[model samples]
Target: MKRLNIGLKEVQGVYDGPEGKLWELIMGEQIHIGGFMESMVMAKKAGIKEGQKVLDLCSALGGGLRFLVKNFKVQGFGLDGTKTMFDEAKKRAQAEKVADKIEFKLGNVLDIPWSEGTFDVVWGEDAWCYVTDKDKLVQGAAKVLKKGGTLAFSDWIEGPAGLTEAEAERVNKFMKFPYMESGKGYEAIIKKHGLTLKSSEDLGPHFASCIDLYIRMLSEQLTFDALRIIGDNMEMFKGMGGEMAFMADLARKGKFSRGRFIAVK
Candidate 1:
C-alpha cells in the first residue's frame, strides 16, 4: 500500500475539531461500524471476563472501554493521542460513575507507557487505521500483554479484492489514514509477533451497509445537525458526503473493508 503524508497531527486535528463531532453525531459515541453490537461480538470472541485488565489503543471517547467496564466488569485503561478525546472520555467516565474502574491517558499508541505484561487484553476498535506504523502498534500491544493474553480489534482494511494505488491514496487522504492493511497483512503481523491467530474475518459487507446508513443519516435525518457540527458549511458537508459515498462504493465492491481479528500472545 502507498502511504499518505497524514499522521498524528492530522488525525489529532480531526478529532479535536468539528469533524470529530460530526462523526460522533452520526456514529454515536462508539464511532465505529456496528457500534455496540460490534463491541459485544468482539468481547465475546475475545472471552473478556470480570476483573480482567484491558488496554484500549486509540480509545476515542472511551466508548469501548466503558462498554467493557459496564458489561464485562473489566477494569479498562485507555490511551489516545488527542486531548479532546481524552478529556471528554474522562468526563464521560466520571458522569457514568465508572471513573473508578477506568483510566484515561493522553498518549500515542505506538509508544504505550505501560510496562510489559501490564494487561490481560489489548484491544482496539476501528481507530487503528489512523496509525502510521501498525507494525510497531502490534508490537507494543503484544509487549504489554501477559503470557496467554489476548489482542483483539476490528479495523478498516483493504478488502480481499484490494484497492489500486490510486484508490488507496484517495481513501487514505480523505480518511486521514496513513495506510491500510489487508486482513492477511494483519494476520501476518500478529503471527510475526508470536501471537496465536485465533480468528480473522472480513466484515466488508457489513461495513458497506453501515456506510449506507451513515450516508442516509447525513442526507436525510441528520442533515441539519451534521451541517451545524461543521459550522453550517454546506460545501464541506456535501464534500464529506461525497467522500463517504465513494467509500461506500468501494466497500460494496470489496476493495475496502472492516477486518476483525483475535490473537493470543
Candidate 2:
C-alpha cells in the first residue's frame, strides 16, 4: 500500500501559502474539502450537536475542528501525524479563543493515542484519502467511539466500480490519495464492525466547482508568487493544472467523487 507523502508540513505549506491563505479566508472553516457548505450540511445531518466530545482524525490546522466547536458547540481534540500542524492548530485555536475547548495531539489515525470509547464522535475532513489502509482507519475510528457514537467524515472516493489502476496512479500522484475506496467498500467495512450506515451520498459536482475555483484562484491570485517560490517551473505548473482539470472532469462525470459518510457504532 503506497501512501501519498503528504505530511502535516506539506499540508500546512499549502494552507499557509499566499494563495492557500487567501483560499481559507474565502472558503471559511471547511478548508480542504471541496464543498464547504455541503460538508457542513452533511455533518449536521449526522447528528453532531452541542457539547459533544469529538475526535478529529487527521486534522490539519484545525479548520474543521474550529467549525465543529463553533457551530456544534462540540469539544474538539485534534489528532495529526505532524507536530508542526498540531502546533499551528493550537495557535489557531488559541487565536479563535477556543483554546480551552480544543486539544491537539501528534498521533496516528490508525493507532490513536487516546483510550477507547473516549469520544462521542469521530470526525475527519478530506484528509483521510492520504491513509493507506481504510479498514484499519475505520476500525480505529470505531474503537475510540462510545456505543452509539457517531463517525462522520467527508472524503474523496473512487466511483461506483472503482478506478482503474492507471487512473488511480495518475490521481494519486497529484493528490496524494493512497487508497480511494468505493461506497460499497465503506459500507461493508462499517457494517462489519456493527456500525449502521446512516448515509452515504455523492458530492462530485461540488468537486467540479471547487477544482474550477482552485485553478482560477491559482491563476488570478498566486501564479506569480507560486512561480517565484517554485523557480518558475512552467512544466510543474502545467502538470498541476492538468491534474486539477482531470479531477474536475472525472468528478463531474462520476468517475470519482467527494462523499459524506455517517455511521454509528
Q: Total clashing residue pairs per candidate?
A: 0, 0
Q: Pick the candidate with the highest lDDT.
A: 1
Tens digit per residue, CA lDDT, model 1, 104-213: 99999999999999999999999999999999999999999999999999999999999999999999988899999999999999999999999999998999999999
- Model 1: lowest-lDDT 10 consecutive positions: 223-232
**Considering only N, C-alpha and C atoms within 3 Å, which residue pairs clash in candidate 1?**
none
Best by TM-score: 1
Stretches of model 2 off by over 4 angstroms after superposition: 1-29, 34-36, 228-231
**Per-model TM against the reference:** 0.99, 0.87
lDDT of 2 at 92: 88
Relative to the true structure, candidate 2 has a C-alpha RMSD (angstroms) of: 3.1
lDDT scores of the candidates, listed in order: 0.95, 0.77
RMSD of each: 0.6, 3.1
lDDT of 2 by residue, 147-225 (tens): 9899988888887645667777788876656567777778888888878999987777776788788778767876776
